[model samples]
Target: MAEVLVLYYSRHGGTRKMARLIARGIESTGAVATLRTVPELVVAGETATPQQADDPFVTLDDLKNCDGLAFGSPVRFGNMAAPLKHFIDSTSKEWLAGTLIGKPALVFTSGSMLHGGQETTLQSMMLPLLHHGMVIVGLPHSEPALHSTQGGGSPYGPSHITSESRRQPDNDEKDLAIAGGKRLAMIAAKLQER
Candidate 1:
């Protein structure tokens, strides 16, 4: 079956929550949503591996095989979290092979503050996908929440802010993430139809 990969990295679980909501939106459209998480970064000097409490790690092959993608990350100074960027950086082989060419893609991010670079982080996530020739997708103004939301969704993508970390998505933000995923899947299906 064709699948939309909802891939992300979350240290405080905020991004992971967004990923789940997006996955729900993808599956609501009858498209399979494959949720995948990346492992914690291992430093060069670290002898011991960090054990992830939960969340399975993703492989490059997973990204290569997906029909569409919903990439998410926590914002780090107006940029995507390092682990997610590290994964994107490693996709050079796929870029060279044109493995992602024409695949529909979208991005989402969580920030600590209202202006915590969420849009910038989302844009940063888009750069590699653009370089790989994947078609970019984003939330449209047609979504009612986009007009009414006092928090998070943008034409660039969806985002969230939590009171504790300032990066968790509020209810509206979660809805926007799902809407973005649904739109991406619909677009992917349309591309396939064409």
Candidate 2:
């Protein structure tokens, strides 16, 4: 079956909630949404070991195999979280292989404050995908949530403002995320026809 990989890293679970909403949107379009996340960073002098988390950690093979991607992260000083960036940096092999070329991709983020770099974080995630030659997708104004969301929906992608580690998505944020996912899946399905 065709699959759209919904991959992200969440420190406080806020981004994870958004990931789920996006996955719902993807599946609503009859495309598989494969939700995955990156492993946590090893602390200073800590031996690196495997983790058994709620969602399986992402592998390069998953990227190579996915038809589309919804990449996300929690904002960290106006950038994507370190774990997600670390994984993206490791995808050099996939980039060299052109594994992600032409895949439809989107980005998302969650942050503490209204202007805590959510949009920039989303854009930051897009740079790597663009380098890999993936087609970038984003939330459109046509999504009514974009117009109404006072918290964190952007034309760059869907986002949520935690205000202080709140993990739940408000109505407009949920609507925008789902809309973004549906749009990405629909685009992926169209690309598959070509």
Best by lDDT: 2
* Cα-based lDDT for every prediction: 0.85, 0.91
Q: Which stretches of candidate 1 lie over 4 Å from their true place?
A: 43-49, 165-168
TM-score of each: 0.92, 0.94
lDDT of 2 by residue, 39-150 (tens): 9999798998876667998988899889999999999999999999999999888888999999999899999899889888988999999999999998777888888888
lDDT of 1 at 106: 89
The candidate that wins on TM-score is: 2
Model 1, position 32: C-alpha lDDT score: 95
Residue 65 in model 1: shift from native, Å?
1.5
List residue ranges in candidate 2 displaced over 4 A: 45-52, 164-166
